[model samples]
Target: MGPLTPDNYELVLGLICFFLIFGVLGKVLLPRIERLLAEREDVIVGGAARAEAAQAEAQRVYEEYRAELAAARQEAAQIRQTATEQGAAFLAEVRAEGQQQRDELVAAVKVQLAADRVIAEAELREDVVQLAVELASRIVGEPLGDLPRTRAVADEFFERADQAAGEVQGSGAHA
Candidate 1:
């Protein structure tokens, strides 16, 4: 160390080496790494967007299904109401038919009773006439066998019946 001075030759050589190495790496390896990173970022963003779209589609489908279910329930209720009304109407019609049948039966019974009463009255009149004719035969001490005389006796009996009916109505008015 006779003259303590620094040499610039080695420093220049080191700087030159560093520049050459970095320039080569920037042109080849660095660009390839950057391209890989960009591709990875694009893939992540695309995946996130697809997941959001799928979720929205699922929500829309669920809403549509709920609406359809509600509509079906309403339709079922309407059908039940209609059936109930029809059943009630049918019952009313059946009741009306039964009532009509009952009325017809009552009318038929009344007609039959009236007919029976008329037949019994006719028989009673015939018996009364026979008894009167027997009494007349006993009083006269002879048989009255003429048809005309029997008709005359029946006519007298009817005249007596009309007189009795008039007396009964007169007594009822006094009561």
Candidate 2:
């Protein structure tokens, strides 16, 4: 036999050793390794499931938040619209009250002005009558002063003058 070839007894012993080692690895270490691999697979799959559940929960919460936000925005818009309408109504009411007050003030002022004009006309007529009496006394060269008669004459003269002025103003207006 060649030097590379084993003897029959050595070959039988090597075969026995190989069989023993293979059986030990198959019965003991192989099962342990398979159990470890199963555990690792469970960990990876469970972790992925948990991550997916967490992502689903987060999406639900985000959707809920968006819905609430949209509701809040709509509520705020309604509030603004209500406030604007109320403000417009209040402005209109205030403006109407102000206009009423202005109209009343104008009417009162016109009434006061008319009363003042009548008072002024009466005072001017009295003053004119006194001046006429004084002028007539000076021109007649005596106190031809019958006070009642002189007042009556001045009143008649003013009535005629007022009539002529009214006629002239009426004709001018017509022209």
| RMSD in Å for all candidates | 7.4, 4.0
Candidate 2's residue-wise lDDT over 105-175, tens digit each? 99999999999999999999999877777787899877755666787787788889999999999999999
Per-residue lDDT of candidate 1, residues 1-175 (tens digit): 2245435776688778988888888998899999998888877887788888988888999999999999999999999999999999999999999999999999999999999988998898888888887888889988764557797879787889979999999999999
TM-score of 1: 0.50
TM-score of 2: 0.69
Count of backbone clashes, every candidate in sequence: 0, 0
User: Model 1 residue 103 lDDT?
Assistant: 92
Residue pairs in steric clash, candidate 1? none
List candidate 2 stretches off by more than 4 Å.
1-39, 144-146, 157-175
Best by TM-score: 2
Cα RMSD for candidate 1?
7.4
The per-model lDDT (C-alpha) reads 0.86, 0.92
Runs off by more than 4 Å, candidate 1: 1-55, 131-175
